[model samples]
Target chain A: MADGLRVGVVGATGQVGAVMRKLLAEREFPIAELRYFASARSAGSKLPWRDTEITIEDASTADPSGLDIALFSAGGSTSKAQAPRFAAAGVTVIDNSSAFRMDPDVPLVVSEVNPEAVKEARKGIIANPNCTTIAAMPVLKPLHDEAGLVRLVASTYQAVSGSGLAGVDELAGQVRAAAEHASLLTHDGAAIDFPKPEKYVRPIAFNVLPMAGSIVDDGEFETDEEKKFRNESRKILSIPGLAVSCTCVRVPVFSGHSVSVNAEFERPLSVERATELLTHAPGVELSEEPTPLQAAGNDPSYVGRIRVDPGVEGGRGLALFLSNDNLRKGAALNAIQIAELVAQQL
Target chain B: MADGLRVGVVGATGQVGAVMRKLLAEREFPIAELRYFASARSAGSKLPWRDTEITIEDASTADPSGLDIALFSAGGSTSKAQAPRFAAAGVTVIDNSSAFRMDPDVPLVVSEVNPEAVKEARKGIIANPNCTTIAAMPVLKPLHDEAGLVRLVASTYQAVSGSGLAGVDELAGQVRAAAEHASLLTHDGAAIDFPKPEKYVRPIAFNVLPMAGSIVDDGEFETDEEKKFRNESRKILSIPGLAVSCTCVRVPVFSGHSVSVNAEFERPLSVERATELLTHAPGVELSEEPTPLQAAGNDPSYVGRIRVDPGVEGGRGLALFLSNDNLRKGAALNAIQIAELVAQQL
Candidate 1:
């Protein structure tokens, strides 16, 4: 685990990839050489890595032999096509997409929660858990380890940035267009209005869409984001029998994704002691006022509203609110942590 | 109880007050005479009601001699002063503020769920249930009747309109500023920004805030909105033993308040039957795709995502999402419904 390492970030011009670059610079990841790759659309785009400008190369045509490590933030389609090639070239691939996450061979790792899982990465590429799963794992791991997580009911308010740079730009444009008293009555995806809703189906300026991702099949009328919540939680926490029901919402928020979680544990746990435990827990920042904006750009998951359900005696049931940076801890931070852990494990 | 009744609307020019006028007109309330009253700021404002323009009078100093019913949507301070005065003059006050909702004698009415409670209102001022309560009641009532509701664990994504026009302007302004790429990072509330955050603590543009009300005394770290949720649900549902723990959040959405609720019932109820019941439930509209925008300007509480929780299967638990116009069903609509019901009994 020496200081110098060659690192390459795929989808360099995308949202998570841009943050990966920023985090590398901010966290001072000991990079001897840095390479940037993107799709043909953003092929020659210049991405500022700290003060150094790195020109993006087309990922499909780019040679991966020079890079010691490659971070993938491109969509699942791109990651599926290119990751194995990079991995086969002996580059340790850390993916931030859903492509190989649920593959039995790939180990889904969250550094602070499951650093040990990285050791089981037999397929060369280590999978990063979904943003929602990434956010909750830090907070849940400690509690789940202590009392054994029985059931989890989570309702997520996911920020637009989780979608991509397009998400941020779309929301920004909506905010601008909604400023002038535009008639919302005649302006829902119709005419005579704002940025024309390029990102979302509806005007996100003043609305929230409950359905996030296509309602892909796992049955129970669940969206792909909701399925990710269940599948990822099972993999990360190793709670295969865990009863989880999630309603993932796309809010007008920009960065961090916030979840209100009701967790029923096997044994009793007190709120007072949980607060004391979280104060000492790693990667879990305890906040009296936890909001999406406060958790934005931060690495730690901000947890608050620690209380026991009076319906359950001996504090077996607890409710909490947690917010995590969808870009950082939710994607780039976890990937960086995994890289750091890989530097240790390998 | 007749087909026509004299009705006076207090704080007519204000936010919820304007919606009260809209709902009343849209529903075709049998109004023999309609009077509009507002603060000194809106004393000369003209309001349209059922194809007639009503002249607004100063509510604080107005004579309340002959009105049959008075709906108050003004602030708590205004309600504290004017409600009793109007009530003393024999004009039944359907108050919309939290000033008197908890009072035992006052009937907190959500007409679809608790109309019978209104007949027992000895207090002239009948309290309108909290907006959150109003949105959740229709679905909970039928289910609670069939199987006793044991606990409700909820997280709310409330709309800005629930606060008032100032909130709408706050959200709109923050979006505008964020769009123009104005400074939000260093915004200390200096006067230059167009969407300068005036109503909330942080910029609402592309953000979700957990802090809705001032951190009041909740024994522990529970927010005022959280406490309101717990206490208000108890009063509205008439189930004191219903354990409720809620995290109230302000989303990027503009109009409707959406809630993710997990309720445990005494008898084992299936999601199939629950869906069938909620499909025909009063004031509740079951939607496969419910968004904050669609619920805006509509009165029905939208419900979906009905799934069975195996953890509480012995007690029959269902996870559902509820979205309703916070201004209408939550504030103005509920108040007007109470007025409509009270008009029948008068």
Candidate 2:
């Protein structure tokens, strides 16, 4: 216990930050001292840690020199501003935002897929892949190792929690307002009045919006979430030229994010062999039928419905579905795992 | 009005059958006389048609000698048992079931895509495509015609109504049971006690189920709904050798079914040209962001999010999304449109 490390959590009041705090305690991470930090608005508040309350520090103004590691789950802007400052103070930062993921010096690491890459973080900052991308890494890494994966067509069913607490609130409010009108929705979906949507472009209660993130105005018509899936997959898998077409959609589910992937490999990959590989794959489990409800609050990415994609000639294609808790394995747990890797190196 | 043809609707007490009756009146389908038929249990019941109550007749025992056309929205077994009987009695039968869709003697028709195929119904029975397949037909028809589509990868966000009234009841019951536990669900989805699911394998209220229909025993790991999309799309588009991979997922929405399609063509198809074609295509409308709520009770298939697939070489692939009313354009309205074509010939 005396050899334990001192750790700090940035944006400790946010949704993913809260999950990080819970998981650190649940997993019994080696911690000699724990600290919480948020914006100035939440700085003076106290958060409970191991039967004691710790005063929150303002991340923008606080000194992080004494901390061995800091997990950042604040938005991109906060990470862009505070990550380097904390890192320069000798605190290794495992950031869960997109701000530093694409930086060449800052390795984008999935703890299971690329934990060794943590040593390559010359900037003293390791970037955790996007939650949607993180869910697919553990599932795709094993497949890519067996057969050279060439092309991928992925369609996602994302949950509201990916957008944080506000998304949760919007979906909950709409569901409460419209649950009694389920009969009316069965006949005419638009007949009832839903509270005007604030977090999403459409109602997220009993509906699905194909646009998950705001579209990038580069005339490509791909959302940022879709782009992240393609970019982060290639970087983590070390397949620089991987062909990917991704459609990210927001569904009514609250916690889990699922993806239906049709992958074309360079070599012939049979369903049986793929299933066997996935059966033994780390951080993955095989299910008969994978649903978001089964994955919520779970650690492993549940994968199932493996089949040969007939669309690809010579049986070189495999189609499968996977679901994972967006908050657990997707964000906080992965960041914590990266921190663990850094701890080992230190 | 005097020259109008006599029409009959089978399974008039069912969900799609109710939509059939409503559309028949809304479209003013030149019905000189209207008749209703269902199973023996509903045979003696009364249904309204044009302000007049019509007593339902037993579909198994009814004589159809005088009716010019009969629309069947019953289950597959009912269609197989009664469609041939009605057709043998000189009534053209348009079936909304999977019973005869792959039958060579029966033409699988999507009214907007291949209305001329109506003449090839050699058995006097025309089959409407599955609701999930129907949602993509109008959106894909023009692009295929322009680019000679060769391969397709589709992932569906299907509504509960596609599963019939029981599915609707299961989802509604679960939503009503779990709506108040939204906060709990946002953190731990499985913590809430949802009603035991009957129509679906998993709770469908706030979850997405990857297995939409039961898996076919052919060892392909494909659901009947997924197989239907591949088989029906090939037949309707007249590309018998087209390669297709489809994943059918049931969402929480009630009425509209949506598909994300990545289509590869023999010739390069530009996003601009595909958008232009879809803009003018019959039974298709272009929207900025298409959702199920917007497509419910609508006649056209709403399409948007057109992009060039970076995975396909030479700009030969395009990606798009579409939504349509699963009950209307997918089942009931399509059957009625086929009836209209048969009426023209009669």
Candidate 3:
């Protein structure tokens, strides 16, 4: 840890924030000094970092003078408000929010897929692609290189944790209620005294919500999460013309996000070749049947159930499934990995 | 009710069998005499149909003499052995098992989609399509009729109840344990004390199992459920040339199976046109965001989130989501509805 850099973690008390801190330590991310920041309500709270404790500062008022790098996992508004300010203060911001992601100046980087893109961050800020997109990058990058990937249809099985701590609590509470009334729920779903949904539009326990994100009012009729998948995948894969139709669904899983992808390419791609590519791909692991449980708390995006999609003409399409820990590889770990890449340059 | 028919429900003690009995009474199928039949283990058990108790007869050796219609919700082997015997005895069998679905002789029917096909049951066996296939027929029949569907890519969120009572028990048991150790599961999926899975490959309490059916050794590497989605969709839709790629996932929900379908047609089908068609389609209720909870115990296949799939050329592809009660519409209800059709003919 000789070249440890001073780092500040914004939103230190949030769900992804907790994982961010853990990865920083677990991955032995070089750190000389650490500072934690949260909203005003959580200011002055203490968070442990290895041998010592750090007092949390309200992100709105925190001074960014001495920090070399700051990770913002707070929400979009916080990144929109504070990221530029930190950049002005000479701190590189690797924002985990959607704020700077689509910005022309900021680079949306997936460490393995587009690490070199980090050097082009003109605004001194890098955006972490959405978790769903990040999970796809490692798997798609390898495939796209082999076949000229043209179109994709993705249906996701997203976890409750992607909605943050409240989503987790809602699912936990509902599960408890449903479990208690197991006999009732088995025959009749309405009889399970499900708690009134607070965080989601419907009960998140033992249910699959077809609508994951808030429906974007735009006439396109896609959820904001769905839009992010299209936009982010295009930017990260550098395939601006790539067409995607995605249905983002929230499942009862705790952490991992699984995607069933059917990709159509310009050229024919066999299951055998795709398997070979994914087998040696960075940040991806091939499994027989990848599930959330198998991917949770793990680093690699597990890919499996590879088959030829006969729907596309002349065997040009391939259908496969993938699972990745939304919290780790999807969010915190990827951001930390980007920070690590930035750290080396510093 | 006019034209009351004598009905015998094979596998009357099973999960789907229970639903069949309830639906028979609920729908007032004009039953002059209701008889129950199950395997020898449950032969003597009594189940209440309407105002009186009906004893379950042994399916293997039970006399099929006087029964006009028999609904078989038992496993495939039972349906294979008993369906023929009943059919030979002049009783029409609406078999819910996969035994005769692919048989060219058996008319595989979804009551709303292909009621006319019921007249072609020359073998005296009308096969009810798989639960997942039944949910898609109503939604697809309208679209296919309009645009001439050529291809389909389906990703399913099937409830545990689709697996039977044991699946429900496994999920209920796991949820109980997960709720007891909520904190452990929320943070670490591996930390949860999940019971050894008997009905499923992995824990199904709060997780999604991508592999719904056992992988068939046909080298296609697709699960039996996946194969059913392909074969049944082709047969029921009567689009023998239709190409299908499906990933069937078992979710934690006690009832209601949801499907995310991306379909390509020979002609252009706009979102508005698709929505309009689904609005008045039989056995389908168009919801803004269809979920398993909302569709549970409901007969209609809840369809929503209709969108244009830009993946296909010439504006030919459409994407949509649908949910239906796996036990009702997917299993028992369809059989009952087919039985009603048969009753009308009788």
Interface RMSD of each: 4.7, 1.2, 1.1
Residue range A239-285, candidate 2, lDDT tens digits: 99999999999999888999999999999999999999999998999
lDDT of 2 by residue, B1-346 (tens): 2689889999999999999999999998998889999999998989998888999999999899998889998899999999999999988899999999999989999888999989998999999999988899998889998989999999999999888889888877887777756555455676768867888877887789999888899878898888889999999999999999998999999889999999999999999999899999999999988898899989899999899889899999988889999999989998998888887887
The lDDT of each candidate is 0.81, 0.90, 0.90
**Candidate 1: segments with Cα more than 4 A from true spot:** A1-3, A40-58, A61-63, A180-198, B1-3, B40-55, B58-61, B182-196
- By descending TM-score, how would the candidates be arranged? 2, 3, 1
TM-score of each: 0.91, 0.98, 0.98
- Candidate 1 is scored at a TM of 0.91
Pairs that collide, model 3? none
Could you give the DockQ of candidate 2?
0.80
Better of 1 and 3 by lDDT: 3
lDDT of 1 by residue, B215-247 (tens): 677575677777778887788888987888787
Question: Model 2 off-target regions past 4 Å?
Answer: A180-185, B180-185
Segments of candidate 3 deviating more than 4 angstroms: B1-3
Q: What fraction of the native alpha-carbon contacts across the interface, defined at 8 angstroms, is recovered by model 2?
A: 0.82
- Weakest lDDT window of 10 consecutive positions for candidate 1 chain B: B185-194
